[model samples]
Target: MNQHPAARLTWYAVLLVLALVFSFPLYWMAVNSLQPLFTGMTWFPVRPTLENFRLAFTLQPYWTFFRNSCILALISVGIPIFTSFFSAFAFARLKAKLKGVLFMVILSTMMIPPTVTQIPQLVLFKQYGLLGTYWPWIIGGLGGSPFIIFLYRQFFMNVPKELDEAARIDGCSTFAIIWRIYMPISIPVVATAAIMSFNTSWGGDYLAPFMFLQERQYPLSTQLMQVGYILPSSPNVDLFQVKQAALLIFVLPILIVFLFGQRFLISGIMTGAIKS
Candidate 1:
């Protein structure tokens, strides 16, 4: 497994370049967000100010949008962890007819583009009278994520079966085994799924919330569009700086989540890959 010192140095250099390239947009946004209104494009701000952020809040109910986003993210995080863990446990531990077939059917859903189902889902939610509320997003999360279930099942499958057997011998029920044994050891996958769900609900989604929720109920992702262009009170405001400030605030949570949970996310993903 030994490599030349020069090879290692070259690999490191390539990675550093790629990292900077990938992060450039974020760097640009942060730099622009601090710049004063009407400031032209510059690599670095000549004189930074918080006026853009102030305008972003003044033009929109920034805190309300943030609250909505947090509510959705929390719901998205909790529901999937509850549903996917148990669903994955059943697939991983139990014996059932058509088990493999059922699991594959669930996994197949992942391949279907969300756009294909949006119209039908929209109609369904509208019929249920959930269109203007958070219920649409909440109900959507009730159906546990296929990817997370697969990840959990893979990680569970890798666990020694002897643990389950021993637990059963001690009068542990199926639920008890899952709760007491597997759940404790599944922290990495749990954190991974939670953060993924949070990110998707918090920022990765725009169309669904925009379509389903009321204007006041719109989360930051969808509201950002409104903030960017439709400054009702300040039609003459510098929109570029306002948008940059809004975007920076919007993206900060996702950035922080990734920075902290990336280790668990990688571990969870790799653990699943080892077996399947």
Candidate 2:
């Protein structure tokens, strides 16, 4: 009906406004990144320049930061993919004693704030002399992510058990049933886990690395925090512009990844929701 079209238009207008509102910080960051630091910034830059980008690289060892983050994210994601998948498969397909109790304990952990365990984990790492190395990040990833395990378990539970039975009859082992039968079809959920895990690992908060890594090994997120208080040692440059440029550069990888992964994210969440 004509009325339906008008109503839909009104909803679209409302949603667009909400979207713009939420996106304002990113818009501001982009605007600031292009503005000259000495211009004192406006809603939009009167004179846009790539000078800030040039300064951003000169001001810090940005290449090192990018590399470190990539290493951390890849390791973090890789460990979870295989470990969480098998853990989920076990929880979903295998019969075991006290399964419900063990699972409840794991789920209970999500209720406890991460801050509460941060100190204990830090102390434990320090005791093992892992404080200043990538071991902490690697070890933490290998420890198993309960959230991802839960996601996998949920999605795995949604699959038909008949698949397992059929695979077994065809001389497949437990691992084969998972790798051959379940995994091939679990693309959506797996993608969701990988994307979400990478995002969590790549979050702008550099505090985790800040606490563990030495100054030279600090990531861009940590370096950017220090940038605010200490402008580049050079006296002749614009400070604000460099900070904005760094913000833009620092966020680009995650932004690019999310853009490419968004379709998978949507489909994966939809597929997983069929069970949960």
Candidate 3:
């Protein structure tokens, strides 16, 4: 059937507006980061300079924070992807009598407001002496995240049973099946989980590192809050430029990753939404 020209034009117009709405902030940030310190707020920076970017690296131990953020984000994203994949595969393919009940119990955790458990989690981490280190964040990611597992399980279940049966007939073990066949076909869901996990860890401000670490060990999110909000009392403070630069440093990595992975991210999200 032929498409309606007016409807297509309307859809394109709507998308263009939506794109501008989403992109405006990023555009402003990029523009602002290049502006002179005392230029004030303007639509366009009259004198663009690399001074903000330069000051960002020079003023704070920004590189250290960047490295720490990368480590934290990697562990937080990677652990969930690995653990959730196997757990999801089990839920999708295994035939244990307790499977349904156990899955329900796992899913139930998602219903509980995360805030309700924050204090308890902090207390537990402190008691175990895991605070002030990466352990807290790492442990959180190591668990089979309920939402990710649910998404993966749905995708895995959609794969033909014949694939598993054929692999088993050839004497392939569960591990072999997962590694050799199922995983190969599940790239989109994997990408989805990775993107979600990475974004969550990269942007998360309230938990994980917050309760578990001190100022010295704070990740980019916490550090950004510190540097951005805390203005110097002294007149000598290059407060405006320094903070702008710091914020730019903190945001650049995530922005770069998103730009590079956007296509895969979109594909993954769409494909993962398809129920088996």
Per-candidate TM-score against the hidden true structure: 0.95, 0.93, 0.91
Return whichever of 1 and 3 wins on lDDT. 1
Give the poorly placed runs of model 2, Cα more than 4 Å off: 1-3, 228-238
Ranking by lDDT: 1, 2, 3
lDDT of 3 by residue, 1-276 (tens): 366999888888999999999988767777777887767665676788887777677667777877778888888888888999999999999888999999999999999987798899889988999888888767887787999999888888778899999999999999999999988888877887787777778877546566778777777887777555323456454457556666766667677777877887787777767765
Q: lDDT by residue for model 1 over 106-129, one digit each (tens)? A: 999999998889999999988888
- Best-fitting candidate, scored by TM-score: 1
- lDDT, candidate 2, equals 0.80
Global lDDT scores for all candidate models? 0.87, 0.80, 0.79
Q: Which ten residues in a row have the lowest lDDT in candidate 3?
A: 229-238
